[model samples]
Target: MCSLAADLATLFVAFALANLLVIGKFVGEPAKPHGLVMFAMIAPVYALLAIQAGVYGIRSLAAVRETILRACWAFAQAVMLMLVIVYFGKIAEQLSRLTFVVGVGFSLCGLILLRPVMARLIPRMIGEMPAIAVVIVDSVPFTAPTGTVLLDARVLGIDPVRHDAEMAARLASAVGHAERVIVACPSERINDWSIALKSLEARGEILVPELMRFAPAKLDEYDHHPTLVVAGGPLQYRDRIIKRLFDVLVAGIATLLLSPVLLLTALAVKLTSPGPILFRQQRLGRDARLFSIYKFRTMRSDMTDHAAAQLTQRSDPRVTRVGAFLRRTSIDELPQILNVLKGDMSIVGPRPHAPAARAADKLYWEVDDRYWERHCIKPGITGLAQVRGHRGATNAHQDLIDRLQSDLEYVTNWSVWRDLRIVFATLRVLVHDKAY
Candidate 1:
C-alpha cells in the first residue's frame, strides 16, 4: 500500500516536472491531454509490476543493492508498457517527445528516491514492532545482535529421510514462540528445513552465504543475510479484492452463457446414471481450508461410493457412457463455474485435489510432502498444470512433481494478466483429448 501511494505521488511529481521542462514553468491552468485516460490506465499496471518486483516486500531483509535493482527493473517494465499503450491507444500525439523522455527519467529517479524514503518511513510507522529471535547453525559470522542464539546444525536434528519426534518438538518450540525465525545453515540443508516448516505459522527465513543468490528472486536481506520468507501467502489485501472481482465477472458471465450446456449435461447424467446429477466432493482450498466442489457425475451409480475415489484409468468400467464424453470434452467441469461464483475456486490457479485424491494407488499428499504447498491459493477450475497438459491420473511420481512445480510457480508469480492467459489457454484446449 505504501509503495503504491509513493508511486502515485511520484507520478504527479513527474507530471509537474514534465510541465516544467515543456512550458518553462508550471502553468496556472494546465492543458488536459487527450491521452490522459491512457495515463490513468497505465498507472495501476505500473504498481502491479512494482509489487511483483518486490518493491513492497519486507524491507528489513533486503540489501540496498537489491532494492535499487528491483526499482530499475520495475520502472523499465512500466515504461515499456506505457510506450505500447501510447502507440496502440493512439495517444502519442498528446505527449510531446521531450515531455515523454523527461517524464520517464523523472519517474525512474523518483522511484529510486522513494525506496530509501519508504524503508525509513515503514519502520517508524510500525513503532517498535516485535523483534524475532535468530538462530545460526553454521560457524560463519553474521551481523545479528551480539547476544543472538547460535546453535549447532545437528541440534535441530532435521532429517529429510525420517521424522524424529523429539527433534521435531524441539525445533517447533523454538520457532513457535518467536514472531519470526531465521535459520542460518548450509544451502543444501535449507530445503530440508523449509519443507519441515511448511505448515508453520511464524514467518520463517533462511540465512544464506550471499545476499544475491536467494531463491524466489524476491528475498530480503537482514544484517547481510538474504532471507526467503516461507510461511505467509503472497496475495495482499488490495490484490485479493482485485482477484475476487475478476472471478465474479468472469464466472458470472460464463455461468449465464453455459447454462444451456449445464442443463443439458444435468439431464443427460440423470437419464444415463442412477445417482445424483452432480458429484460433490470435499477438496482442499487456500490455506488448507476444506470446501465442497461440484462437478457433473461421471460414474455409474451402482459402483460403490468410493468407485472413482482413486484415479480413473484410461477406460474404467465405472464411468458411464455420458460421463466419459463429458469428461473428455471437459463438460463435466462446467459446473465448477458455480464454485468460482461461490468463492470456493478461481477461474485459473492450482487445481484443487479431493481429500482422498490418489495417484499410482497412493494418496497425493503421500506421493510428495511438497504437494501440500499447492493449497497456498484458491484452487481453480483450470490451472497452470491442467492447461499445460499435466491433468489426469498421475501414474508416475514425476507427474505429480511436475504439476506441483507449475502450481507453485503460479502461486509465487500470480497476476491478473497471467490468470487471463491461463483462461485463454484453457479455452484453446477445450477440444483436446487430454482431460479424461
Candidate 2:
C-alpha cells in the first residue's frame, strides 16, 4: 500500500512539474488546467499496469534497475492505452502533444528518481521479513537451512497426524512468527505434515528427495538451501488481479457489443428446439475445481449430452439445423462470455474439458497425466488449442496430446500480450473445418 501511495505521489508531482515548469510559470505563460486530464487518465492505468508488471514487487523493491525497468514498462503500456483511447475518441486535437510528451518524460524521470529512495525505505517499512524461519526434522536425515531454527519432531513430540487440538496448538506455537516452515520427513509422513501445515499461517514447504524426477517449476532458496515448489498457486496475487480485471473488462464489453447477436442466437435456438436456450455442463477449472460452463444450446433437447460422454463430430446427426450453423460459425460459444463475467472463466485460457470427456476410448487424464495441469488457470471461451485448430473431435489419443501440449504451453508462458494475440488469432479459426 505504501508503495502504491509513493508511486501515485511521484506521478502527481511529475504532472505538476511538467505543467508548471515546461509550459507554465517558468515559460511566463498561465498553466493549462486541461492538460492535467492526461494525468488523470494515465495515473490509474499506470498503477494497474505497474502491479501487473511487478513494478512494486519484491524484485523491484530490492533492485533499483528492476524498479525503473518495470515502472517504465508499465508507463509505456499506459501511454499506449491513452493514445489509443485518444485517437479513437477523436480527442487527440484537444490534448496538447508537447504537454503529453513532456508529462510522460517527467513521469518516467520521476519514477527513476523515486526508486533509490524506495529501495532504502521499503526494507525498513516492511521490517526484517522471515523474522523467523523454522525447519522441522521428522525422522529424516536433513541438513537444515542456514539461519533457521531447527526443531526435532521426536524431541518436541510433534505428531502431524494427531487430531488433538492441543497437539496442533503445540506445533503451531513451536513455529510462532515464522514466515516459512520446511518439513523434512520420510515419504509416509509427508501427507501428515502437509495436512498439518495447511492450518498454519506461514508458507509451508516439504523436502521430498524423490520429487526430483518431476523437475519442479523452480527451486526456492532458503539461505542457499533448495526446496521444490509443488503446491504454489498457479497465478500470483498480482497476476490474478490483472487477469481478472482484463477478463471483466473484455467480457463486459463483449457482452454489450454482442448482445444483438446473442439475442438472435438465443431466439433461434428456442424456436428451433423444444428446450432452453442455454446448455450448462460441469467442467474442470482452475485447481481441478468443477464449475458450470454455459454455452448456447446447439443439440436437440433430447439428444443433449450433459456429461459430454461423446465428442461432437462433423455433421453430427444429433445437432439441430440451427445448432449446426451455430457450431459451424462458433456462435454457440458466445454465451460463455457470461461465464467470464461470472468469474467462472477467463477471456483467454485453456478450454475446459467435461469431467467425463474422453479422447479415443480413454478419459482425458488417462491419456496424459499432464492434462490436469492445464486446469491450473481458468478455462476460456476460446483458447490457444482451439485457435491452433485443435477443436472438435478428439478421435485419437494423439489428437488430445496435441491440444494438451498447446494448453500446457499456454499455461506456462501466459502473459497479457499473449492472451491478446491468441484472441486475435481466434478470429481466423471461427469457421475452421474442425469446429463442427
Best by lDDT: 2
The alpha-carbon deviation from the true structure for residue 421 of candidate 2, after best TM-score superposition, in angstroms, is 1.3
Best by TM-score: 2
Alpha-carbon error at 375 in model 1, in Å?
1.8
Please estimate how well model 2 matches the true structure, expressed as its whole-model Cα lDDT: 0.77
List model 1 lDDT by residue over 1-436, tens digit each.
5656777778767856776766566542245452233346556777667666665545423455687777678778877887897799886776666666776778778878877777777779877533455564544455566766555545555453332323333455554334466777667777766764453334557776565654456477656556776655557544665687689889999988988988888999998769899888777665455678888989886663442376777888888889889989999888888899888898888888766666776667677877756665688999898888887878887888889999989887999999999989888777656555
lDDT score, candidate 2, position 204: 67
lDDT (Cα, 0-100) at 401 in candidate 2: 98
Q: After superposition, how far is residue 220 of candidate 1 from its true place, in Å?
A: 7.3
RMSD of 2: 9.4
Q: Where does candidate 2 stray beyond 4 Å?
A: 1-36, 53-205, 209-218, 221-226, 230-234
Worst 10 residues of 1 by lDDT: 160-169
